[model samples]
Target: MSHPSMDDMNLNAPHSMGTTIIGVTYDGGVVLGADSRTSTGVYVANRCSDKITQLTDNVYVCRSGSAADSQVVSDYVRHFLHQHTIQLGQPATVKVAANLIRLLSYGNKNMLQTGLIVGGWDKYEGGKIYGVPLGGTVIEAPFAIGGSGSSYLYGFFDQAWREGMTKDEAEKLVVKAVSLAIARDGASGGVVRTVVINSEGVKRNFYAGDTLPLWHEELEPQNSLLDILAAGGDGPAPMNE
Candidate 1:
């Protein structure tokens, strides 16, 4: 009997998740968002996977990279935070949950293939956003973006993100950014999901693919090469055509 090589086995694994995840802090709280596509090789394994995970009643995480790795990290952090909350007789802070993820990610950096953004509201800090990147580095920022799609968004965020944005504005920015990523990044698509947390509570929102406004090339008319050829050498067909 012949057996498959390690490379063949690895190629068949379906837990990879190339994605777009965002975290933005507003005056009152924070908004965490993610795209819903989980890919395996060039195949889309799941079109509507939930990448945002709840770490606590007030804290949520935007997961990227390998879906299995991120899910396990979130599970470990959630378990630890639950114990910590029981010991302290109060909810765990956003920093605590983020640090827990950072520690786990860093400790197993070589074995783990995931990056995460942690966002939440707490009594002490009000609203907070933290980035736990692939190497286990943790950075607190007013706004953060990650995953494959983030490569297309640095300039946009710099131009669009602002301080003291209201809750609505922050949520709008998150949704808009995720939609933009979905348009440009082949690895990012499906729907957009967001978690908004603040002193009031946590709110979840979902935006379907058909509902998101198209942008740039997406807004252009769909014309195939065959259509151009069929135009009888008219150079190019009009967009409306």
Candidate 2:
């Protein structure tokens, strides 16, 4: 009987570091999304890793760059947030979470390896989106994005994104931006995963070209820009996103 080496196991692990993550604060809430592709060099590592993750019932994070680094830091920040809630008798806010991420990656920013979009609703601040980029820089923006696919977002956002968008409208914009990236960027593929934060709290969603977007089963990308545009500019499905 032969056994796989550690490198082989590592290669098989699901940590799609190469991705596109977007966060936007709309009229009364926030929406965050990511493509589910993890790649290493020329090979795709995993397609099903959840890049957009729940932090508090109200706060969530979208990760890009160094998969292991982001995952571990987010886990640490999660624990800290929970502990804060326990000690303070209230849930942690987006600002607090963003600060923690900043502190963790600060000073070591050059060596540290991740960029994050922290989005959530707060009692005092209302809907918020904070960017904790590499080098410990914390930027609060109405809309922000990161990762390999972010470069493709500039034009679409410049043309399509606007202020005071409703949640449904925000979702459409996110899906459209990600679809365009997946079509052009080889590093980003797989199903698009999303999370929304509002007065009611967090809403999680999944988007794809097919009704069932299962990465492990399909082992390939579902829709390209051409695939979506070819199907038509608008469709009843998430393809129109």
TM-score of each: 0.86, 0.81
lDDT of 1 by residue, 1-241 (tens): 8887756556577677799999999999999999999987766778899999998998999999989899999999999999999999999999999999999999999999999999999999999999999999999999999999999999999999999999999999999999999999999988899999999999999998888989986963345476568886556556883
lDDT of 2 by residue, 119-169 (tens): 999888989999987788899999998888888788778888889999999
- In the order shown, what is each candidate's alpha-carbon RMSD? 8.6, 9.9
Best by TM-score: 1
lDDT of 1 at 119: 95
- Which candidate's lDDT is highest? 1
